[model samples]
Target: MEILSKEKNARNCKFKTRHGEIETPFFMPVATKASVKHLSSIELETIGTPAIISNSLVLYLRPGLEVIEKFKGLHNFMKFHNVIFTDSGGFQMLRPAFLIDYNEQGINFKSPFDGKKFNFTPEKSMEVQEKIGADVVMCLDNLPEYGQDYESVKDAVKLTHAWADRCIKAHKDKKQLLFGITQGSVFPALRKKSIEFFNKKEVDGLALGGLCIGESKKKMFDSIKLHAKYLRKDKVRYLMGVGSPPDIVNSVNEGIDIFDSVFPTQNARHGNLFTSKGKLHILRKEFFKDESPIDENCSCYVCKNYSRAYIQYQLKFKEGVGYKLATYHNIHYITNLMKEIRLNIKENNFKKFRKEFLSNWVTKE
Candidate 1:
């Protein structure tokens, strides 16, 4: 990791990977199925995306290891020749349908697609991800849900710690960076325990999991700050499952280096277009006749070439092209936002940038 510049707690760095170098304070769109829903690999490259995160277990179940191995790896299979990160599918534990039971051995999950049960041990997760060949691979973590009690969360923390060791031991790829995940739900003492455990291990990076699920924003940010303070600053800090203008800006200020979430693309599919001022509900009747771009401030291809009237018409009819355009704009906006964040940190004005941004960015409906 090369620390380029820092303003207060926020630092700009470069995380070198086997495929490429991912700049810190960057967001990765979730390509859980080896594809970002509405965009293609070519579009992702054009949007300035350096990295993407995919669900290892999902790919393992669907295309299977045979298909990916036949194509050489995920980069070749997906035609995305940039940096790629494969999530350990720990996030799947949040879904009641997928998670039947979890113990010290591993997790017992049922595939929602095939209705088949499978045992996913830490060693198995390491083996699968290594076969899938992502530049960055995460440890299989036990993520406690938002309202779970301390005892439950403590159990999760214990399991996560044990699994982290197993994952580390099983990981054999020297080129692929293995990141350990810290899960404590919303409990500070449990979070501290998890953090303290990973502090002793030599992982390429540390990910703050089990946040932004359903907890209050205050608690979420507090956890981020806690991770920022305790996790080794030399290695990269990744705050998983967080993506939004306000949350991202604040996370960056709190020293989060990398992020991945489906927020922008998911919200775009639902008609909420991110913009400089705020989110614009593009499907509203008011926009049906409006001739302006999605966001006047946004210089994305969608905004430059298309108008609100055109997009709304296509979206209203459920046209496939509409989804592509909306996803493109939202991703482009986020890409430019990260660029601005890196620039502000380099100029030592990130403090001012965060303040002004938070003051204007509101997510309430």
Candidate 2:
């Protein structure tokens, strides 16, 4: 990876992973269960998605290792050629566990799919990701929800740092890159400590976890501003599980290089369309007679060939195609937004671009 340019706190960079090279600051569409809900890998590729994030937990539990090993790696299993990052399954800790416990041994939780119980140690996470085969593999980190006290946050950070060391020691795949996750909730002091600890580790990248998990936008951005500067500049900086338009713009300005979230695809499945001017509710009555595209400036196939009324009709009738089309358009919109962001950074006009975008992109309370 190389930083090509910088303007204020923002950076224009490029990363060459084992799978392929991608330009940063990029957005990764979430493929939680090895599929992006209503779309295929080919559809995602067609929409210009440079990469994607999938859950290692699902793959480990459902098909087991035998099925994936038959295909060698997730790329072969999913038939996706672009870059892929696998979550270490640490986020599962946030769920309501039928039986849960956390110790120095790691996370023990019941599988929601089956009644079987399993423990996911940092070593185990590394092993699963190695079998699942992603270009970038994440370390197992203790991620607590928002509003945790300082002591709890401090303990989470301690566990995260300990687990990161174990993951580093256990990861043996030379082709796969291991990334350490920083978890300190919104405590600036703890976050700074987490950053400093990982900066000295032998990990290939660093990811900001534990944000946007019910914290206010102000708190999240404040943490980003506080910790991003301390992150190793040469390593790829990923802000995990955040994909709102305004948040993406602000995070990029704070020097975050990669991001993944279910926002666009999930909202699109519910008849929401992300547009240049603002988010549009496709099911609204105002669009029933309107023949315009979702976004006049959108060049996605859905917008180019279909009218807003057509999509609304499909969505109103609950047609499967409606969800697919909407998902496609939303993914295209976000990826294109990333492209525009990179272009603006290259042109040294990122500040202007972000200000103008937010001014027009009205956010409803």
Candidate 3:
């Protein structure tokens, strides 16, 4: 709600949300099924996470409306009282081969658990979100796979915009915020058009979808820069599915306010740990005798209490605590990084911070 500071190199700005003030250039941990993988809500809060993302599609299918209705909504149901955002389930519905059937009217998708066919329209998405009760909800947009032709891309954009309109109309709670997602795969003109369309729609927030699916990093960054030019600076601008440390910092410098991805949790499960310097693979033979903490600078419980050698040994033996420790460290690393970025911005030295961080980070290999 307030602009704390602006970055000189990018359109990044720090703003406050109702639940808590989130520093711009921050990443939202992916909690697709109302929980981040292998971590509880209390653990997430302890790790200093600003927010988490839940999938509207997954919750709608597995728990159905009955479970959420009992609890009054996702926030109370999950017991995560902080800021929460819900993706319209558009992406997940189409990704798996057998999960969905695409049509102009709307998507007719099968529930992965029961194989019962379910239909999700833009209006229905809004209804589901309203019942689920998240602080931020996304419009149900058509997300096309990579390698689609121009006409298909164009049609998807048009449908996305149309659905955004329906979503806004169907939204009953004025207190809840709706964000429109821009969908145009690798086409700048289409991307530009989609941004212009949503800008006029006047949604509370904007997200650039359809990236990081299969596009090159070059294309992804270029598209973000171009879209940021047209997006409203006052409202939050979230770049969906981006959560790597480098990607987060770069996207933040490109004016992205929020992001979510499963990379940290997924990679942590495989023994990868994020640090201020860069990523470290803990399963390697070299760490067998190493006695240092995961990251020397990190003050996380995992870093303070354990060593890389102990984690490697635990992971080698397939211990559940190993996964928990790695996840805690990685999430803590990212959360702390964003905190530092905010401090740098308030001190008017974000450019210096970015340069020094990236220099040490990219040279780790």
Candidate 3 structure quality by residue, lDDT tens digits, 266-347: 8888888887778888988888999999989889999999999999998889899998899888888888888887788778
Over all chains combined, what TM-score does candidate 1 have? 0.97
Model 3: worst 10 consecutive residues (lDDT sum): 9-18
TM-score of each: 0.97, 0.97, 0.96
Which residue pairs clash within candidate 2? none
lDDT, each prediction: 0.90, 0.89, 0.84
lDDT for predicted candidate 1 compared with the true structure:
0.90
The model with the greater lDDT, 2 or 3, is 2
After superposition, candidate 1 runs with Cα above 4 Å error: 362-365
Which tens-of-lDDT digit does each residue in 313-357 have in candidate 1? 888788999999999999999989999999999999999988888
Please, what's the RMSD in Å of model 3?
1.6
lDDT of model 2, residue 152: 88
